[model samples]
Each structure stands twice: as structure tokens, then as C-alpha cells.
Target: MYGIYIYNSKNRNITIGTKEEKKFSLDIYQIYTHDPLEELLNEFREGQFSTTLTSKQKHMLLKMVRKNRPAFAIDEEPLGKIRGHDIELYLDVEIPYPPMLRRPPYPESLESRKESEKHINELLEMDVIRKIRHKEIV
Candidate 1:
């Protein structure tokens, strides 16, 4: 494959490509010098967010993020916990009894089902979701 190179210097902005498809050039050599994934991860960890907002707008956004920091997940972590967050909902519609709704099981291959079960078990272990036995439900 042709190797593409971009040069952005003080006086010039040029893109150069190697002629030979199979020949490995400096452009191709530089490609493997750094991992793009790792660079992106590092940027995320460093909080290097790029935005077109003005300085004042950016400050306001930063303040909001800092204030609601617990609500956002970092590094695949679960959402932030809000202390004393007991919620109650009052519906206008009245029902004689609790409604029971059930859906058919999703169609999945054996391998896919096993994978899903493994992931769900991991989430349960991590306390991301509660496991309720049939008897526990009213």
C-alpha cells in the first residue's frame, strides 16, 4: 500500500505519498512509532477536550462538569452514586392490581447466550445490577 505523509511546518503544509506500493518509507515507519489507541486514551485521561467554545463558555462547561463529576463514568466505571436518592412515583392512572408484563426471550445462539450470561454475571458481581429471585418479587 502507498504510504501517506503529512508535513505541517511553520511555512508549509504538504501531503506526500511514496510511489512504490510495497516499499516501506519514513511515512510508514513513523506509523508504527506510536499507537493511535493509546494516544487517544492518554488524551482522555488528561481531560484534553477540544471545543470551539469561547474562554468564558469553556469555563462554564468545566464548572458544570466538575459540579456533576459523579454523574459521569470514567474508565468504564459505573455511574456516580447519589446519596439519599429515594424516589417515589405517583401515577394519575389507578390500577386494581400490579400489572405483570413479560416479553418472549430474545433469539440468540448458544455462544451468544453464554457470552451474555457471562457479561451479566460480571455486572452482578460488580454490583451494577441487583439479582432478584422469583420469590423475592411480590
Candidate 2:
């Protein structure tokens, strides 16, 4: 149900669904082999993928020999010469984390301290306060 679709540039064709059950679809979009390759490489360089390559993805094309990889290249032969459906290439790329989910700056500012104190005071007045501990770092 959840899978990527890859277009076969050699014959101006496209395949949808999983690798095993790849069904031929219309080739409305032009296939750009180099663009996807470059984007994947850029993502790898940015450390967006998992630390362990094998765990993240079952297959991957090495950077040095990317051209040799069938998924990254398109055959120059005529459409009639090619047989069977083209291979589907899945990039080892991950969706980036939301900006708000990242760590915030340390050392609260004066305005931040005031706002926090006001909120805490309101909570205390509402009798919703739990155990509180204050410590001063040396």
C-alpha cells in the first residue's frame, strides 16, 4: 500500500507499487535519472539517513560507483529492445524533523523567566502545584 513509483527512462515508461508487483503505468512525467541521484547523494552528505545503512535500507548504490548502478542509469537502447519492467529505485532518504521539535536555546532570557514565573504563580494559586525544587549552580 505504501511504496514509491519509479519511471523507466529508457522506454518512457513507469511502474507503480512494490518491486515484486510492479505494474506498468502511464509515463506522464519525464524521468530524470541524474536529478534523483544528485538529491539522494545530497541527503546522504547531509546525514539525513540513518547511521547504519543496512538497517535503514536493504539496498543502496555506493557513491563511487553510482553510474554502474542500474537504478541510477538509463539504457540507451531502443524501447523495443528492452524487455520486462525497469527496476524501481528507492532513495535512502528520510523526512526531516519539524523545526519546532528541535532543541531550544539554553540560558532563559529575562522575558522568558518573567513569563515562566507568571505561569508557575498561576498554577500555584490554582492548587495544581507539585513538589518544587530550586538549585543554584556554582
Candidate 3:
């Protein structure tokens, strides 16, 4: 299991949780990850790879993240509600809501659980997912 913690980047850049050799990447506004999982996620979020770019060139990448606001607004408290957004604006849209049921978590072996725990811890560091105090199905 491996993950990266990018201090400042749009999309929160989360890679798919995988069971593999352990590794991690660290970034400060600028980021470069040498993993296929992250590379693919980057394409969907920020664009392409620039691994060969010089250090000075890498700084240009900082501009790619969303400016003036954090990207994890919906991932914050009372999840899915962005500040200043009026629900009325979406009244006409047929938004897909989650079913009101609690499915048991899939069974996993110890090794798999350990791997997932590491990945979840990494997500905590990046604020891609925050702590929840209670469980409520909606």
C-alpha cells in the first residue's frame, strides 16, 4: 500500500487503494508521483505527466490546482453541501441519492486490512476524507 500527501493541489489527487509494495510521495503545491495509479488519476484530475521537467519547470504545475479555494469542500462536514450553494438550484435535477440501507463491509484477510489501513491513514493526512463521529444512513 502506498499514498501521496500533496499539501496544496486541486482534486485531492487520491489514488486507488492497492495492495502493493509500500511507498509514499510528498509534495508542496507542486507534485510528481512515479506510480501508474497516480498517473492515471492525474490524467482525470489535473492532466498529464511532466516527469522530465526541471525543478524550475515543476513550479509551473502549481497553477494547475484550483485557486482561491480548497478542493475538498464537499468532503467536509455535512458532506456534499458546498458553502453558499442553494439546494433550490438543483431542485429540478434528478440527483441520485444513496439508498437507505447499511450493507456490511466486505470481509478481508489481515494482510489486506493492514494494507487498507495504511492507505486510509494517508487519506487522513491529505484531508481527502475527514473523521466522522457517527453513522447515519441517508
Model 3 misplaced stretches (Cα beyond 4 Å): 1-101, 136-138
Candidate 2 per-residue C-alpha lDDT over 29-121 given as tens digits, one digit per residue, 9 for 90 to 100: 666566655566664563455566663251254454343443332233112222254456564544575665466756889999999998787
Q: Which pairs clash inside model 3?
A: none
What TM-score does candidate 3 get on C-alpha atoms? 0.30
| Highest-scoring model, lDDT | 1
**How well does model 1 score by local distance difference test?**
0.59
Per-prediction TM-score: 0.40, 0.20, 0.30
**Among all candidates shown, the one with the greatest TM-score:** 1
lDDT string, candidate 3, 19-125, tens digits? 23433444447676576444434544644557897644544444443332354232343222234543432334343634433456779999999999998886776
- RMSD per candidate (Å) reads 11.4, 24.8, 21.2
Error of 2 at 91 (Å): 37
- Pick by TM-score: 1 or 2, better one: 1
Off by over 4 Å in 2: 1-105, 133-138
lDDT of each: 0.59, 0.53, 0.51
lDDT of 1 by residue, 1-138 (tens): 445554554433333456433333232323456754455445446676566766566556666766777666665656554546646666665555345323556699999999999989877765556788879942
- Collision pairs in model 1: none
Task: Give the candidates in order of TM-score, highest first.
Answer: 1, 3, 2
